[model samples]
Target: MQYRFDVQGMTCGHCERAVRQALVQVDPNAQVQIDRAQGRVDVTSDAPQDTLARAIAEEGYQVAAAA
Candidate 1:
């Protein structure tokens, strides 16, 4: 399944990388696409939505509502 959401507090490449790393750590093959300009993340994985959101948040970012 695919999940898309807004992620706030990503202001630089490092922030993006941190979010990406967290997502990947949960599902290594997951496809992660981040649109920093829009504060969004497009993730494709079989993982549960809550699980994915937690992973992203644990990386020090806030996961906004799904879009």
Candidate 2:
């Protein structure tokens, strides 16, 4: 499944990597794309939405479902 999230507090490459890593840890096969300027994250994975959101949150970012 594909999921979109509005994530805040990502201001650098490291922030992007952290979020990507967090998502990968939750689903190794997950694919993540982030746009820090827009505070958006697009992910393609079989993992549950809640699981993915929690992973991003654990990395110290605020995450919300994106319409």
Candidate 3:
């Protein structure tokens, strides 16, 4: 499944990586894209969105509801 999140407080490469790492931790093969300018992250994974979102949150980033 593909999930899009409107993230808050993502400002740089590290922030993007943080979110990516989190998602990968859940679904190692998961694909992630971050739009720093728009404060959003897009993820595609077979795993559940809740699982993905929790991982992202555990990495210390805010994962907003999909817009």
TM-score on alpha carbons, each prediction: 0.94, 0.97, 0.90
Residue 40 accuracy (lDDT) in model 2: 99
Better of 1 and 3 by lDDT: 1
What is the Cα-based lDDT of residue 35 in candidate 3?
89
lDDT per model, in order? 0.91, 0.96, 0.85
Ranking by TM-score: 2, 1, 3
Residue-level lDDT of model 1, residues 1-67, one tens digit each, is 9999799999999999999999999999899999999999999998888998999899888896575
**Candidate 3 weakest lDDT stretch, 10 residues:** 58-67
Backbone clash pairs for candidate 2 read none
Compared with the true structure, model 3 gives a TM-score of 0.90
List the candidate 1 regions with Cα displacement exceeding 4 Å.
none
Better of 1 and 3 by TM-score: 1
Please provide, for model 2 over 1-67, each residue's C-alpha lDDT reduced to its tens digit, 9 standing for 90 to 100.
9999999999999999999999999999998999999999999999999999999999899999998
Q: Which candidate achieves the best lDDT against the true structure?
A: 2
- Candidate 2 to truth, TM: 0.97
